[model samples]
Target: MSNVTTINPATGDQLETYAQLSQGEAFAKVDACHDAFSQWKLRSLEDRASVINGLGKALRDNKEELAQLMTAEVGKLLKDSRDEVELCAAICDYTAANGPEELADEKRDPNNAGRGIVTYSPIGVIYGIQPWNFPAYQVIRYAIANLMTGNGVLLKHAANCTGSGLKIAEIFQQGGLPDGLFTVLVIDHDTSDEIIAHDKVRGVTLTGSDDAGRHIAEEAGKALKKTVLELGSNDAYMVLEDADIDKAVGICATARLYNNGQTCIAGKRFIVTEKVYDEFVEKYVSKFAAIKTGDPTAEDTDMGPMARDDLRKTLQQQVDKSVENGAKIACGGTIPDGPGAFYPATVLTDVAPGQPAYDDELFGPVASVIKAKDDEDAMRIANDSRYGLGGGIMSKNVDRAIELASKHFDTGMVFINTFGLADPSMPFGGVKNSGYGREHGGFGVKEFANAKAIFVGAE
Candidate 1:
């Protein structure tokens, strides 16, 4: 039988072991979720709310343990990890209070109207394949959204966070959930594809890479199942000439280093106007340098180790290749020789197109600073990427910022001053290669709902 191993990315130590479900076991899980969906879907909206609300309370009650596990497993800073747990709780509350209203329909064409009601029915089990970066948030975003819509979930979490994945199942289970409401399949990718192809899996959602999203979306498509994919991102952080230099630099620094720069929306490409480029660079570099990097578990530690040894290597190679392509290092560039998987917060300046870091999602603390001659060049650079996820723009003139932000940014979510945000009420998804389908918000609820339109006889 195949086994799942949990390894500490920071210490490179083996933590525990879990067995991958056999073919029969995997099918059994699918069948269990399928069977439970029949009853789960029939339950009142309030019953669904109760379990989801319970999950939020459990997260708080066990905040210390859950957050610690996430930090140890995936290298998230302790405070941020705790915040994620709370956010998961908040999402639970958000959906419970708003889900019924969102799912309910309104009447239209009432003056000469026939009986017309648009109803949302629950689809079958939804298969979710989540990433490790923001374990709790990534899973909960999909979890609460889908479950509230009456769809069971079969999650195949990242290999590194399999332990946390199992614990997540425990949270729902202990909170008085049905057996098949949400099941974490302990298996690798080979088994994952099989799970997605299962007849009981009516739809799918994934938050990973462009490649993985494409692969899963393709497989689900082949099965005629619906898919919601949140893929890779190359988020841009821009500074215009009339920007708030201090506020801009400070927020940019925090966004970049949050989660040790392991975030998908971390400002990988920083485009600053030439008029204020030097000033932004100076303050941004000093702020980046001051960030404390050490044990993620330590309260004082502002940063943590990279998620895994391979991620450290992958980010390092991208930096080296960018330099070879003529990008200049403005700040820390080299990986310090050490036992832990730690890399210094690096910054590269004068980065042009055709370099690896220019339009790519560098899932690390490395930021590439590019200078634009004018507003035209700035927009050109920002809109260059096919991955439109989210971005940060800095300008004291909010009007100009919004104008440039709308015209320039190719991303789905644009923050005038900050970048790292995905609220439950906001519609979160990307354009182009960043993948499709919305999570959270009203649109997110419909992703798993089967909208039934009824037409009455009209004369």
Candidate 2:
């Protein structure tokens, strides 16, 4: 068997190591989870809600320790890590309070003189393959929804944050969750594929790159299992002709560099109208250059190292290729000589089609600036990508922005005038190459549920 090591991205030091489970052990856990679901699905909605509420309380109580662990694992800023814990706690609270209604049965009209009832029934074990970006939130986002829907959860978290995944399972148990309700599988990719194909594992959910999503989806498809995929995106934030340039500059900078710019929904492409492109680029570059990068545990650090050294190298290569393809580095493109996986806040202008900066998702602290002819052209440029996860529109006219977002934006989610992440009350997912199926709000709990229709006729 292999071992998964947790390394501190901020300091380039090893923190802990976990032994991977053998094939037999992993399959046994899946069997146990399936057994738990058999019992869990019979529990009343009120009983499930009580356990979920307890999970929320436990998350709040251990917020500090979880936050610190996430920072160590993924190098996110300390404040951001804390906020992630808070978000996860809120998801627990929301799921516990609103899940029953979302999954309750509904009465439907019958055409043949019969009464019809549409019931949302629980599937069996759900397997979640999550990433390390938001260690707790990513798992909580899907796990809580599945748990609330009376499905047992199995997690195959990214190798870097193995400890975080195990810790979350511990928290769930401490919160009064029944044993085997949630299990963390410490296994490799081949083992994960086998688990997906297991008969008892009814569904699969993934949060990762497009390539990984496609592979997992293919595996799940072959097994005739349901899957929910949340992939990567080079989310665009457009600055139209009537946009507030100063405000756009500040918000755009923050959006690009948030979470050290590793977010799937972070603003990667800044599509600006030619009318205000010059001023926006000037101020945006200045703001990026002014960002402070240091230890993630520090209170005042603006940015931190990436989750791993290899990720930093990939970002550097993408930037280099973009520059070679005619994109100009405005500022902060060079990698600093350091022990940790640290890359400076980078901005690449003169961006166009065919370059990585324009064509791909740069999952790092690198921003792509694309110039458009006008507001109409800006929207066209933003929609020109293979990704449709999320995008933002910066305009002084709220009504116009809303209309554009409703009618023109091709993305699954749109931000009118701000930059943000997942909200407990809003649906979160993507379309096209960014993958399908919605999570968050009330959409997630039903993704893996079986909507069965029953009809009764008088004798």
Q: Please name the candidate that would achieve the greatest lDDT relative to the true structure.
A: 2
Q: Which pairs in model 2 have colliding backbones?
A: none
Worst 10 residues of 2 by lDDT: 108-117
Error of 2 at 401 (Å): 0.7
Model 1 accuracy (lDDT, Cα): 0.85
lDDT for every model? 0.85, 0.94
User: Any runs in candidate 1 off by more than 4 Å, and if so which?
Assistant: 108-113
What TM-scores do the predictions have?
0.97, 0.99
- lDDT score of residue 221 within candidate 2: 98
lDDT of 2 at 370: 95
